[model samples]
Target: MFALVDCNNFYASCERLFRPDLQGRPIVVLSNNDGCVVARSAEAKRLGIKMAVPLFQVQEQIDRENVAVFSSNYALYGDISARVMTILEQEAPAVEVYSIDEAFLDLSGLAPHFSLVEYGLQIKRRVYQYTGIHVSVGIAPTKTLAKLANHAAKQYPATQGVVDLSDPQRQRRLLGLMPLREVWGVGRRLSRRLEQQGVTTALALADCSPAWIRSHYSVTLERTVRELNGQPCMELEACPPPRQQILCSRSFSHRITEYNDMRSAIAQYSARAAEKLREQNHLARVVTVFIRTNPHSQHERFYSNSASRILGVPSADSRRLTATALRLLKSIWQPGHRYMKAGLMLSDLYLPGHFQPSLFEAPESPAAMRLMQTVDNINHSGLGQVRFAGELLSSGWQMQRNHLSPAYTTRWDQLPVVRA
Candidate 1:
């Protein structure tokens, strides 16, 4: 058996964690640069605020409804997510961190030892008690069904945030009732294709032959079908596969036409991407920098260009990445355009020992690597207090985060305060 636990309205919940007064209020978390609605609380959903709706488009409705608006507070959310995952790690034998707000647990022999429903409820209670975050738990014979059960747990209030579909009959009933789109791995396009073929429900897709599904759709879809039918095609991944590329980029709060501002933005992005590479223990051989004018602007002539640099040797050192990114920025930058966005991408990633350098070139020295590690440690511990000189964000070059919440869990100065 497998169980999936998912945080409910994660970003909104994180915002409400420190501001208890905001509980039960409509909340909307905007995307980078306050571009659009990325997350909405249940109350916001009830107000018909659709996901990805531009902030300007819903300003009137949000103001009239008195919605608690927030920019994406990722530092707070990431810290909260880590705390929740830590609590979960203690409860489950093995856990797969599915995403920032979801995890799957392996319940192999435990199912026969105890009631899965009770176990799910226990996890929910413990997590909430420890982190003040409500989570929905779903248990089933397979991961895919476990995800469906989780969906039901969150969709229906009567479940009390815990649902068990371990029974075959219960699985079939839920599958029948669930639309194909709700099934894991099935998106709107695939759901419509399946519905047109008369496989309109989760059970209908499950009933289709695995080979037939594979031939008609793809192998991944076939695995989903099998998993839906109580067969576990996927196992708990303790360590997720490494990414081939790391990108750090964001649209500026406002456009800039200066060279120094664009260079500053690219340098910051490069440092961020390199930091991610080090976090994953990978070294990148190729660095690509890109700059672009606002595509949506009618007054400005849209210009976009990108340049790539091959490192002398693969390295995860931040200084090297930032320097390369700045040089690349210089090549593609045109002075006249109002640059709206700039970014860095580090590709050709490989594990530290896996890359064999040429005779003339060598990887980063052990001492240099240690120095980088020390710097990373300091920056991580201090929420980016230590950094390269080029990393400073030029005035007005940063993303628009007008409604950002304090980094309550990660930053000491931003810790929550209480009064009696």
Candidate 2:
């Protein structure tokens, strides 16, 4: 069996973890530059505030409704996600982190040992105790059904945060009641197609002819069908390797009018991307930098730009990657344009140890390796960011606006208080 564990209203819950006063209030987290609503609490949802609703479009409604608004506080959310995952790691035998707010646990061998529903309740209680966040667990024979069961658990109150679909009759009934669009792989296009074919529910799709699905869609769709029928098409992956692409980006609080300011933002984003590349022991042959003006601001001019540079050799070295990134920024940068956001993307990635050496380029000496290690260590320890000989710091950079939250879990100074 596989169990899918998902956090409820992750971003909003993160906010409540710190400010307990907002527990029952309508809360919403805005997107970069506070442009739109990216996340909404249950109360906010009840007010009919949609996700990605532009701030200007809903400002009147939000004000009239007295909704509690917050800028995207990623630091707090990331820390909370880590804590939640740590709790799951201790309770489950093995866990695959599916996303920031979701994970899949292997429960194949443990099903006979204990009741799955009881075990899931224990997990929910422990996670809440440690992180002050609520989670919903779904158990099924396959990942797809587990995901469906998880959604059901979250939708209905009687489940009380746990749902098991191991029984065939219960699985069929739930699938029959669930909308086709609610299934994992069925999106708007596919859902419409399925509806046109008289398949409006998940059970209907599961009962479709396999030959027709194979002929119309790819083998991937066929596998989804099998997984929905309790045949596991996907195996549990342990220690999946690092990502092949890394991106670091954010929108500025206000439109930037100067070219130097744009360069500064790109440089900072590139430095962050480079640090991640080194941390994961990955090398990139291509560096991409992009800049854009706000699309929603009627008063400002709109401009979008992107530039890419290919390196002679793939490298995880910060100096080489940052140099390429800056060059890419130079190519993409425009004069006299107001930019709202800029980002750095590293692609054509490969593991550093697996990289093929160039015959012409000289290898780094032991001293050079030690120096790179020192820089990485210092940055990791939070002393300072990356520093290189050729790189010059730019003064005009956008500041992170939502960094005011207390680091209650990660830092000693910000730890929560308790009365003796």
Q: What tens digits encode model 2's per-residue C-alpha lDDT throughout 11-39?
A: 98888887877878999888876778899
Pairs of residues clashing in candidate 1:
none
Write down the TM-score of every candidate: 0.97, 0.91
Stretch of 10 with least lDDT, candidate 2: 388-397
Q: Give the per-residue Cα lDDT of candidate 2 at 329.
A: 75
Task: Write down the RMSD of candidate 2 (Cα, Å).
Answer: 2.7
Residue 276 error for model 2, in Å? Answer: 1.5
The whole-model lDDT of each prediction reads: 0.90, 0.82
